[model samples]
Target chain A: MFGEELKQFQRLGFRHVLLQVLNFASVIASGLMIWKGLGLITNSESPIVVVLSGSMEPAFYRGDLLFLTNPASEKYKTGDITVYKIPGADIPIVHRVLETHDVVKKKSKRSKTALTGTGEQLLLTKGDNNEVDDIELYQGLDWLERKHIVGKVRGFLPYVGYVTIAMNDFPQLKYALLGGLGLLALVQRE
Target chain B: MHNIFSRVNNVSALFSSCMMGLLVAIALSTLLFTADPKGNLNIASVKVFPMKNRRVSARKQDLAFVNFNITADLRPLFNWNTKQLFLYLEAEYANGQGAKNEVVIWDRIVRRKEDAVINVIGKNKYMFRELSSTFKNVPPAHYALKYNVMPHVGALTYGEAGRTLEAVPFPESRERVS
Candidate 1:
């Protein structure tokens, strides 16, 4: 029972509880800071991503952790794994680059995202396990531009991101986890 | 006091810390296996033809078909941590817009060291078309045989195995196959 915990909490008084709350807040703040710092260093919106689907099999399975980086000056090449989000699609896709076409332009305004070696790049992608190219997944678009791409997959970790997936699938687990952590933080002494 | 709650927490923390350390070690180990194996890549022929789009037959497109030969020894690339090797033949070219392009025409996945020996004659396996649907006015294209090393639990690495001695030019588009 929490009788002993309550007695300890009462003995600690409200100031100690406030101190504990402040400590918890700092812990969360530091976590967010580290995430944002990694984003800045990698030049990606989300430097770490969890594989949500099994489209890319044998290489990346669902629940795997993927590290990504989007170098602004670099151009995508064939066989490079990329995570991209179309305008209307809510979830991003991870696929290997299948084709890249450097289009010739007569006169064009400079785009904010300048790809390497000049001109705009038109890329086509496909999943390693899929039979066809990713043209159908582009949502009526012919090619995937640099803007639609999130980042290129660089490092990988297996099955670690499954915790987040489990939390997402079962709402009760998420609440139970949060509640347990909060109770522990509040009840713990020092 | 190592109560059930504290025991669970401590055990999980140690387990995860050990896992992180192992992952870091595996990631760093790939740095030690630096294999730069070279080979020969020859483009025997390049044939361009005006074709209908696979999806929309009404639209006309230019498709380049290439026949190539590759000879390399990639057994040196397969180390203890190596999971598989993804070998690809890519065509690199630039359009008038000065944009550089790389397209993989053929690819093979080598999962075993015995298959790492690179000696093959192959042709394009996927469609090879430009964004403009034509290769006309496109500069000469260079073909290179590249390989990507995937590890069991580490960073992915890339390297060039072989390249055509001279950039191959995209031949004029033919009306129909003879």
Candidate 2:
């Protein structure tokens, strides 16, 4: 089984194999470029996110995919589902905006961009399935500011992100997948 | 050119792309299902009192208690794609400093079309308070019944169902209520 492929590899020579490696590397690089570029256009650190918890159940399951966009000029309102990350917390939470207070801050030229048609808005979020609001989850903070939020959820996809979750749960599967793809790329002729 | 590996790869590639196209079409088809349902919402009563918040430091915060009535036939909002409806009551007001606020005092999830015809005499399910932590000099609030339509797949949509005809004013905070 190895003899035929070894002969082909020898025939192709080191320079041809190196060129193939370059082609494979470029393909991966371009994929990353498109993902990061989309994130920039959407103004979300992560343009797409997978639901990892059941807090927002009946609407989003554990592996559902969510699309997000944060329009810098727009203000979040009550009932909009927002994906927010609290400081020191690694995972983001998806919950609905239960309260929005546009508190009047002293008008300073430096903070002008923070003010919308409404004053600087402060938000409180609550999971639909949870019994109470997310005050306890804030970690001593009273309210969630706009900065802590990743984005407002706009579109949803069902269970498409389970592939990533499956890979995460099984490291062996991940390595096997990566190794198989690498071997195939090396062995296959254009 | 016509090897077994290439044939399997071509078939799989075509199959995945077709599935993607079908999903996109289903997501876009929601735009054509234009449904705006209307109903009635009334504020039965509103009372306020100064109370200490124990979760944080012991500081007096004006807590408003509200009782409301809702009668909305939200069946029109449900379709095969609709997973559920998140219904909520929001209080819209402005403080003395002219800062606007919208707060959801109560909410319920309706998972079935049979349960979408809502008729309830309910009270605030969550704590209702102003950002300044006082209802004194806070303007009267307008109550609106809104809904978020969550789909099994595709974009989520929102709409209003009903609103109180008049703004409800918070009564002067009593030191204590018997």
Candidate 3:
């Protein structure tokens, strides 16, 4: 099995392998560029997110793909679905905004620039499937501030992100996929 | 150049591109159906009562109870791409300290088009509490019925269906409910 592949590898000069490697690197670079570009346009750290849990059932299911946008000038409303990450929690949660409190900050010398603008917004979120609000999930905090939120869901696609979830569930699948892709890139002629 | 692997790759590439095109078409079709439906939201009564804070028994808070009637024919929002409709009743008010608040008191999920016509006279399902733990000195609140239309494969849309013509003032907190 190795003899034919080895012979073919020898037949292809070292320059061809270098070219393939460069091609692979450029493909990965373009992917990263697109991701970063989207983040910049949306003003969000993650412009695209996958629903990891079924907390918002009937509207969004597990493995559904969600597009996010975090406009700096806009304030979140009560009905908007938001994807937020608490300080200590590793996984981000997707929930609906149940309440919003725009607290007025006292005018001080340090905060003079923000005096004309709207005050800080404190939000309370709840899952659609849950019976109660998310105050218990705040991790000792009374309310969720704007900083804890990643972005608001704008667009949705169904079940397109299941591949990532499957790969996460089984580590061997990830390795196998990576290895297979790399092998194909190295061995393919065109 | 035309090996089995290359043929399979070409077929899959073509298949995936066609699938992507179809999905894009479906996503774009959501924009064509633009319907704005109006409804009536009537606030029958509003009452505030002092209650013990569930999280901290040592602290006391004021909870507002709202009774309202909603009549809306949301069937126009249920297009082919519409997956579900999330209807919420929110109370918008401002405090003396210039803090603005919007709290959702009741909500319902409409999954089928037949269920989109909503007519209900109900009370608040979720707790409605102020940030300062009391509703004293807070201005009258304006209640509105809003909805979010979730699509199966496209952008989500939101619209307001109804609103209280005049702000409804919260009654003084009574010591007990008879």
Number of the top DockQ candidate: 3
The DockQ values of the predictions, listed in order, are 0.64, 0.84, 0.85
Candidate 3 per-residue lDDT over residues A1-190, each given as its tens digit: 7998889888998999999999999999999999999999999999999999988998999999999999989999999999999988999999999999998888898878776887789999999999888988989888888899999999999999999999999999999999999989999886
* Worst 10 contiguous positions by lDDT, candidate 3 chain B: B53-62
Could you tell me the TM-score of candidate 1? Answer: 0.91
Candidate 3 local lDDT, B1-178, one digit each (tens): 7789789999999999999899999999999998999999999999899999667346778889999999999999998899999999999998888778999999999999999999999999988988888889888999999999999898999999999999999888877757
The candidates, ranked best first by lDDT, are 3, 2, 1
Question: CA lDDT of A179 in candidate 3?
Answer: 95
The residue ranges of model 1 lying beyond 4 angstroms of the native Cα positions read: A1-4, A108-119, B96-98
Of 1 and 2, the candidate ahead on DockQ is 2
Q: Write the per-residue lDDT of candidate 1 for residues A106-153, one digit (tens) a residue.
A: 443665344433666788998887888888898999889999999999
Scanning candidate 1 chain B in windows of ten residues, the lowest lDDT window is B51-60
Clashing pairs in 3: none
Q: What TM-score results for chain B in every one of the models?
A: 0.91, 0.94, 0.96
Predictions in order: lDDT: 0.88, 0.91, 0.92
